[model samples]
Target: MTRTTGYEPLFTLKPVAPEIWVVDGPILKFYGLPFPTRMVVVRLTDGGLWLHSPIQMDDGLLQALAALGPVQHLMAPNWIHYAFVPDWQRAFPKAQTWAAPGVQERAGSRGLALRVDHQITDHAPDAWAGQVDQLVVPGSPVHREAVFFHRASKTLILTDLIENFEAANLPVWLIPLAWAAGTLDPDGKAPIDMRQTFRKGREAARGAIETMLSWEPERLIMAHGRWYETGAMAELNRAFRWVLR
Candidate 1:
């Protein structure tokens, strides 16, 4: 079965901080392996929402999000993470969609009808510039993710960089696969193959890691599995030690 177990009570917003919430969504198969999905919701200072790596849109989710604020921005944090963005853009028709470097090309290569309203850069855009800080992490061409840090919440938002899948939640056979991929909980970093892609881009990857570490984030959120609720400095150092050190 390609359907994997996920955090239950999916597609509902759960509080993360004062203005930050997370929506845990259904499992999606990646190359025949099921992986749980998650997305971050930040109600900006203007009451508009900035969704990071948006999950599936359902009626209840749409209505609940509408109550929060207008979905102003739909984020494609990384190339591989933009699958559901097309649906989200249809739901929030006026919402501006942002992509990381190479995400547009990646989407096109996949034959996904996606739109790119803006591309993330070293500086955050006027829409979310003051409230949130963004950086396009340089490393693997396919994994060049636009990572965000919400200054108000001191939360670091990431997608695919660190996937911490719990052993018990996965199928017994998948546990070994997780270990081989280096996604086992408590030690999750990028998957083993993704790490190889950073070899040629080591300096660039280190620069990105250094920037993320400099943020001194308190909470680290990732799309897959359990995220670090505290001690982000240590976690950042530990997770990126392979490339950074």
Candidate 2:
């Protein structure tokens, strides 16, 4: 199965911890879209599958997932990340849909019908029964963020919280902005918009960051930037220092 349309797959299977795989694509350069957003695939204990943040579905990606096992669960970590849910649900109709709290209402406002099998809350960790650990990053209505950790991989997965851009992929005009925002390299800069978004709940946001940092992830996967393999927890702490203060 190969659905090659809007974008080509530039697959990088990051060994964040162990069984977890971080699949991502080439960066969408023109508009500061660094890396084709990442999607986390977890191999469940039952040999079933659980997917977090389903990227745009293509036959190729779909086939790749099928090879893993039965995709029993599809999740929308937050409101802004639901664009590809319809296609994924169509592809795996038997898969149960899960959404972060408020996601259904948000989807309804967007005129997208969502069949959510469950809604994630602060207690999602217990609800998920150690299969996955979820935390609510309190900030941004558009984001209403949910961060995930795959116990099998010891990997922490996040969307939009940290974006690390590749210099070559950025347009000349956006390069300076990217550099300043900390998307360029090891300096650990948060994107300007991300900075603004984090300001909404300084204390709450910091607490969330602290909670994730406490997990001590071996690798960090971001939706819009490069994935960090080493010292990921340190990088995350550096990038979010502003919120800490």
Candidate 3:
């Protein structure tokens, strides 16, 4: 399918692959500076929507998504990406909320009551099996990220594992920190904190990274920045190269 339109609307709803739509949300103050967020909506073979790393869901956005398919699954891809989960759950009452390991605990810690219907494991659930593959990326004790592979689209969906921020879209003061995090655009890499996470549990992290690499994904969808179209696998390998080495 066609990649982005080179421009992201207020809630950019664009198709990155078959049965997958990404919505770029508003800029929020992150680390005391403006930062953007994104979410992916996947229409399963059964015509149910699986939300990955959800963003702020407004009436307009909800209407747009409903037109595509019934919201069936709201997924918290990682501990750090569950902020807007309660909002989505309220919108789609019938949808089953899936939590990545440690997500429920983390949400509770923040006093944000979460509705986790099921916990996502390394194996793909019955609702999405054969169509989508999943793996729980280990090593980050602070954030356990559940990565997904859409078999029909050969696309890998990641949350915060790799962050790419365009310097022009950020405040001048945030640029240096972004660069230090290895998240600056055109040279997107794993965030510094995540790299340290891997260092703590390198062996386990390596196993998880190898599982992701084995998928040989053709495209990638990220939560904080632009997704990768071509050479997705290469970009992925590069992002976690330190651990890979």
Candidate 4:
């Protein structure tokens, strides 16, 4: 059970964009089923790093991240992804933690005293200004995913919005379940149950998608499964086809 954060087998760290890096976290059980998790790192204009959806940080990983830049910001893209915020906050005491709406309340409910210093809205913060553009995909009551675009690298970063899990990568029994949910590879999409929840806020969700498309991103960095390096915009439109229709 050493899949998620806290008890890590160590996360693999690598560079994904010009100044952005990633730590591929260990697979954790989602509803008793295995699921992959990822954490993204972006270097801000002021020579500090902005961490998105931070994963388990071991000594080695911390050292590696330090080599990239000063860790100045820690972001929780959604409520469900805030579990690791406390760990990162303690590790980087000076870093500001940005919350994605409901995260503060959810963290409190889970008995975790998370320090979320700022809220992530449509406006890009001064630290990441000119480098990253942000959008909040509003729909589900319990979650609101914050998506970011790296202007320099033409990369779009997302969490839980567009998931494309390869069938071979999943446990045998879970393959059918993922496939039925429209989360399987070759044409990865968001979870069907999650999409159904958009009925009440479909317009807001569409607005977010439109904003993402406006960026004309060349690559996509997802928090789950494989990422898209080419034709990213096309894939985004395809993944959110239901919302668009």
Candidate 5:
């Protein structure tokens, strides 16, 4: 049930670049399925912190993040990824909360009075425009995930788009399920269900991939499982081949 985060020293920042870091958090069970959590922290050019899909936070984690910089933006990268945004907002009341499409509706469905300050588009907002780029992958109504690429670090950030669950980290029973869902490491891609959403018109997904490749990413960060430390372009192509084809 544990090890979903996969990285060590849970809830602590792991430096990826001078301006970028990752925090692997505790496992969260979704509909009886145990899923590890992760978040991307980016320090904008002006020194404000942009949190992408923030994980659960505690006092120690808050103090550690405070040391990084001012938490200016709390981003809900996708609809379901906003669970802990309220916690972060409560801590840093001044931080602006941005959400991807459908997040507000998802929150309402769950009876959560989530505050969404702005809706993300395919382009980065002026807040971090030159620092980060965003793309809204089309062809799916339900899985309208807006992905990001950090220009300074050449790090591409994805949510459930590509889940690479390591066998060693997954539970004994989850190993097969991960494999069946095409989320196992070394050959991971978008889950079968998500891929299906783009089946009707994958050209949009392929276009998104083309744009991502144009960024010449050096590494990749995913919310679940192991993220790539290098060869991000190849992995990006390999992981989204189902939709690209």
Candidate 6:
């Protein structure tokens, strides 16, 4: 983890795979849970940039992103991850913002005005012409929870679906929950919360997992936990066994 000091809240940039970076900020403690939040950056073939679940933008981070390339697309893969879109849009006015289906409606309920250039659907892969692959992980009240795979880097990007936090970092009360949920590394298994989340739409979630597994990605980049560098598909299978069960 490359740490950035002198910032009010420190942010770390870690490269999960080639041309794929995971930017992690301070721990967000809410709902009696402390989880590391992250954002992903992918460099596209056309010299354009695609950001997945952008973290809170500061002048430093914004300048760092601008130096990389012109951001052409900003994606909010799930409704819960929409908090930073407005700030990102304001920073990169030229970029086209995208939200998953029903995101705008959900955002409105939260008193947020999300101006999306496009709403993501199953056909989005075809629309982007294989530039990115998106799979909707069905479950949880939070709709539009799509997992993304960037073709250029063969990196599967996820948010909230599979978390792999180290046990030492968690509070004592949370440790048991993390252990029960299979979130504790190195053999981090999918937690009970994730299973419960999947129970609501087992069929749809299974289908989405099956579709994503077919990609045979070598690396898995996650938003709230440690990324998998090798045998990513196998890890994914192990984490989401509730679908198979």
What C-alpha lDDT do the candidate models reach, one value each? 0.88, 0.71, 0.84, 0.84, 0.88, 0.74
lDDT of 5 by residue, 1-245 (tens): 33434577888889998899999989888879988899999998888999999999877888888897999998897878999888888888999998989999998999888899999888788899888999888888788888999988899999999999999988799899999999999899888988888877688788888999999999999998989999998998899888666
Q: Whose TM-score is greatest here?
A: 5
lDDT for 181 (candidate 2):
70
Q: Give the TM-score of candidate 2.
A: 0.83
Candidate 4 lDDT, 1-245, residue by residue in tens: 34243213347567676787778887766678777888988888788988999986678888888777899999899877888889999988999999899899988998999998999998998888889899888877755888999999899999888888876677678788888999888778888988888889888899889988999999998888778888998898899999898
lDDT of 6 by residue, 56-143 (tens): 7766776776677788888888776788898888878888888877788888998997789987766564335677788677655544
lDDT of 4 at 94: 95
Taking all chains together, each candidate's TM-score versus the true structure is 0.96, 0.83, 0.93, 0.94, 0.97, 0.85
Candidate 3 Cα errors over 4 Å, as ranges: 1-7
Cand. 3 TM to true fold: 0.93
Q: How does model 4 score by TM-score?
A: 0.94
- The better-scoring model by TM-score among 1 and 3 is 1
Candidate 1 vs 3: which has more lDDT: 1
Best of the two (1, 2) by lDDT: 1
* Runs off by more than 4 Å, candidate 2: 1-17, 26-35, 125-128, 180-182, 188-190
lDDT of 2 by residue, 81-161 (tens): 777788889888998888887788888998998888877766653335686788888866555778887666668888767
Clashes of 1: 0
lDDT of 3 by residue, 42-131 (tens): 999899999898887778887888788899999898888888889878877899999899999988998999989999999998999998
Name the better of 3 and 5 by TM-score. 5
Model 1, TM vs. native: 0.96
Q: Identify the superior model by lDDT, candidate 3 or candidate 5.
A: 5
Error of 1 at 139 (Å): 2.8
The residue-by-residue lDDT of candidate 1 on 1-245, one tens digit each, is: 44545677888899988999998998888899888999999998899999999997789999999899899998998878899999988877899999888888988998998999998887998888888998887867657888899999899999988888999789899999999999898898899988888888889989988888888899999999988878888988888889877
